[model samples]
Target: MLKVKNALALISEAAKSWYSSNPFQFSAIIAYYAILSLPALMIIIFNIVGAIWGRDIVQGEILGEISRAIGRETAESIRMMLVDQGNEKTSVFATVVGIGTLIYGSTGVFFQLQTAFDRIWESKQTQTNEILVVIYSRLKSFGFILIIGFLLLISFVLTSLLNTFSKRLHRFLPR
Candidate 1:
């Protein structure tokens, strides 16, 4: 079909454009994500220090005032939680809590970046296809990285097993 041919052409052209533009766009995205997350980083540090101290750092007086200036709801919530004592002590430090939060936040940015790139290709559309294909193309390029990660894991396991077996062999063979 003519439409199919046109769509393929568009896809090819989009892929070329995506390849040409990806490095700059991806780096810019990562930089912006780091910058925009400054507020969250503050929240992380405040939470961390609070956990370490076993009390909220920004709950009252001067620090509370500073937090209010930074983020109203967050500051108020932390203040209330600290003062009211309604919520149980988390018994977790900032660095530990932040790992999960960072994972979720980074996952959000990944989807957002995928959406942005797909939109870039969609704007060049000749016919309908899954927007996911553009996203898939980006992830496909990451396959090599994924393979390397898996290989590293396998290598670690194999090395551990070899060490254990060697120890067992030495014991059974009498030194």
Candidate 2:
């Protein structure tokens, strides 16, 4: 019982520390960057996905959701941007440049998230060179993006299977 009490105390202290770290400030910063970079990030994701799935199908669903959430005008703008980005026929150099820009743009939110998480974990130390820190941060954020992509693929597959099963069940049910 004493050990349980001690563990609780430790957890409470950690929670206090995290809350005192002004996490909301960092959250707002991340949100701002996420909004600013959303188009670029979506462009990169849809292009890669467009290779495997029809881009129009994906974009149509995304636009429908976005319209419901944001509004038709905003969704239309996003749709236009995604279409333009994915439809480009570019030279190798141009393609490389575009992808590089997308990576940098997309990682802004993740980098801010990492900074906030480090503070909450209280693992921040005297940092290394600025360039080195940026490089490491970008690499870490890119890893997060890859994980999200994997999770999204899993989600899509699961949803497809579930939808198919539900449709089959409906067909078998009495009206």
Candidate 3:
């Protein structure tokens, strides 16, 4: 029982050390995966467009049609409509991709936490309870990304406000 207690303590200490040392890694990873989500969004849009138009985008030269649809517009209204639609579609595609990436990437930290606990608790003589305790000990470490993301959002809002304030202050200050 003493050995078990020592093992659990070791695992707890290791988990604490890891989380404290690498607090930002999780946020960085989440951000990286979030950025990569662009491809996923493009693929989704490509499929949706193909389904709606009854054409295989890769083989059918769909962009040509889109270009033509905009080019053939003799009226200003038609040109504006085409341009607006294209822009809207592109924005939707990007948003879908980003959200998809964020959601998928959110699971990565959990898997890492699971692996860390498994390694930390894997004694030849250890029982399941110790392993479970180790896993629970590390679960909070996986939440670093979520916390960082929230903080980043708050910072972004604050930065935007600061930019506005700076602009106003610039008008009052000499160059």
Candidate 4:
């Protein structure tokens, strides 16, 4: 009985803190930035994973799986948005501008999330205006992106192995 009461009290406190933190506004900002950055984020991960397996093979398998799961039209739309072909004749200057936008867009959600954390903790650092702190926060967000890429690559490898094994197993089974 006492433990249950304590647990409820803790949850109540946490909920109160979250409620006071302008959660709706914070989440809206995060969602907006996430939509803007999804393409660039996927492109970065695809490049990292593509480096391990052949790009063409990986992309084909991924697209096939996506199409199977979410219908061909949705998968094709996402592919067109995210995957840039070298033969598209994109301008070098435009590419540079896009890269700059990608970095900023990807970090925007993390910056807003960090601000929310500070609000919840009632953090008031005197040195918050330091340039180093700003750079560190942005790098911290980039580190998260790297971790996500690594995890995605691992998922792709594991799923491919399982798929290959399943096919071989199916051949050995009764019709």
Best by TM-score: 4
Clashes of each: 0, 0, 0, 0
Name the TM-score of candidate 3.
0.31
Give the range where candidate 4 is weakest over 10 consecutive residues by summed lDDT.
81-90
Candidate whose lDDT is highest: 2
C-alpha local distance difference test of each model? 0.55, 0.79, 0.51, 0.78
lDDT of 4 by residue, 1-175 (tens): 5698899999999999888887898788778878777666767667767888768776787788789998999889977765754447678998788777777677767776887788768998667677877778888987888888788778878987999999999999966
TM-score of every candidate relative to the true structure: 0.28, 0.78, 0.31, 0.79
> Which residue runs does candidate 2 get wrong by more than 4 Å?
1-19, 86-94, 125-130
Residues 32-151, candidate 2: write the lDDT tens digits. Answer: 999987876676666655556566766776788899999999999888777665476789999888779889998888898887787877886577688889998998887877776666
**Where does model 3 exceed 4 Å of error?**
1-105, 113-142
lDDT (Cα, tens digit) per residue for candidate 1, span 1-175: 5698899999999888778766677767866865665444434444444443334322343255657587767767655644554244555686567556653443444445655666665656444566665445435533433443355445545765899999999988964
Better of 2 and 3 by TM-score: 2
CA-RMSD of model 4: 2.9
Which residue pairs clash within candidate 1?
A: none
